[model samples]
Target: MTDVTTPGTPVSAAQLEREADITRRVLESFDGCADPRLRQVLQSLVRHLHAFVREVRLTEREWDTGIEFLTRTGHITDERRQEFILLSDVLGASMQTVAVNNEAYGDATEATVFGPFFVENSPEIAQGGDLSFGAAGQPCWVEGTVTDTAGKPVPGARIEVWEADEDGFYDTQYGDERVAARAHLFTDAEGRYRFWGLTPTPYPIPHDGPVGGLLEATGRSPMRASHLHFMVSAPALRTLVTHIFVSGDELLDSDSVFGVRESLVKDFHEQPPGTPAPDGRDLGDRSWSRVRFDIVLAPGGS
Candidate 1:
């Protein structure tokens, strides 16, 4: 008889014992993987995946459905949209990864999810310039300071800002506009930056696709709280990607992406009509809001 102990050879086992042996063999087969780190990660992933399958006693049909779902998610992803990222955000994986990667020391700004809406090569704008392109919403003045953890200013830090209008629709949502309500600016010598933006409002995640279907099936809401997104960067400091949520928004307690942190919540003071803006520009006769968000960055390579 052929040797049964050899790799790839048949072996006899009770049905209950087969799964355990298979797990062991699959892990052992990676012993010669050249990259040690890759081996370690793949081994761990295999263990967890196998454990999950066993715990759920996953059915064949369920497995096939999952494969098909992932296939569709990949198919829908393109330059302007990312369905896979939406799936990860809803599943909490994206936030968890951010938390693991960003452990700021002292009063450094906390990091949050880089949502699917971010676009590269945003138009550079001057301080206090309006970012909205006639989008519907009450204009708001946003001013902020950028500093190191030691409380020293970080001048010339690049600040990229973007947000949805009152209607909960981003400029990218409309095909006519290439860019709106999003721009980049640099901090002044005092580490201060300002811009005119819209008061963020609650909006639903794109729910016309597979990720949306998953949310609905799981009895989850897809509403994200009102918030302003920021990506601030400076020399010798870690780039910070985060958000400042509008205080008192109904969905703040239950942001669909779980991106909110207590430290990131901020109050937007409502100013009466004709209140002067931060850059000495007149607000005319319309009401506006003001918010101050100061950021502290951790040293680079931390």
Candidate 2:
């Protein structure tokens, strides 16, 4: 006896039958898809989309509005700004995809959202080198070791590090070809790596587009927690893209992209002014900080 009358507006049983028939026909049309995975995905997507339409009883005007919003999102996307990725991020789709792909195994570190700022063929640096590259921020000495989930060292792992400057902007945002606060380094034979980079400061995701409008309409913040980005890779090991958030950052609970994981937060111990550097490089009268992030990568097959 229960049907469309259960929620939304009361509708006749024949109306429900008509709507269901459309969904069924659409799903059946994909039965001839050449790819098995494509057919499965199409049918599943149709089922969920039809169910959503029915559940919400979406109005034509609302659908048109959504279409317009998506069109604007595409219009604002470019090589410098990936609005689609930003949209996926704000909707939690990126993190969900990351979660689905990066299965947990032992103490291996968790994965996180890969933001829109990554560039290919970053300049390589040696261990104990400065990654800051003259970017503006408090000096931070970052050191870590790369190991497999089995606790075995994975020497020569390539670790890519990048972060925003103190003014809450990446070097790319300066509208020039300069590369600062970003570099890659190889672990030593002992699987240890170190570099100098900025202590990450809180920043806003580029939110001036339709995605920003959506966030504003929903009463959500566009701020991300202070954190450092890392992309670690080695042969026979799964590549991991993640961030190490400052432990005491207030934005930890509310990163705009939902990229924060409890395991990824670490303490950045502050060193007083005139403190001796571990590598014997003079930090001068400037205060500095250090953090250790020992990474554990899962096997590639995982």
Best by lDDT: 2
Instruction: Please provide, for model 2 over 25-70, each residue's C-alpha lDDT reduced to its tens digit, 9 standing for 90 to 100.
Output: 9998998999999899889999998998888888999999999999
| lDDT of each residue in 1-302, candidate 1, tens digit only | 22243446454556436777889999999989999999999999989998777656668999999999999999988877789999999999999999999985889999999999998888898877788867789998999899999999989999999898788888777766568889899999999998898988889988889999999999999999889999999888999999999899889889999999999999999999877766777768989899999999999842
Which candidate has the top score in TM-score? Answer: 2
Candidate lDDT (C-alpha), each: 0.88, 0.92
When summed lDDT is taken over every stretch of 10 residues in candidate 2, the lowest stretch is 1-10
What candidate 2 gets wrong by more than 4 Å, as runs, is 5-8
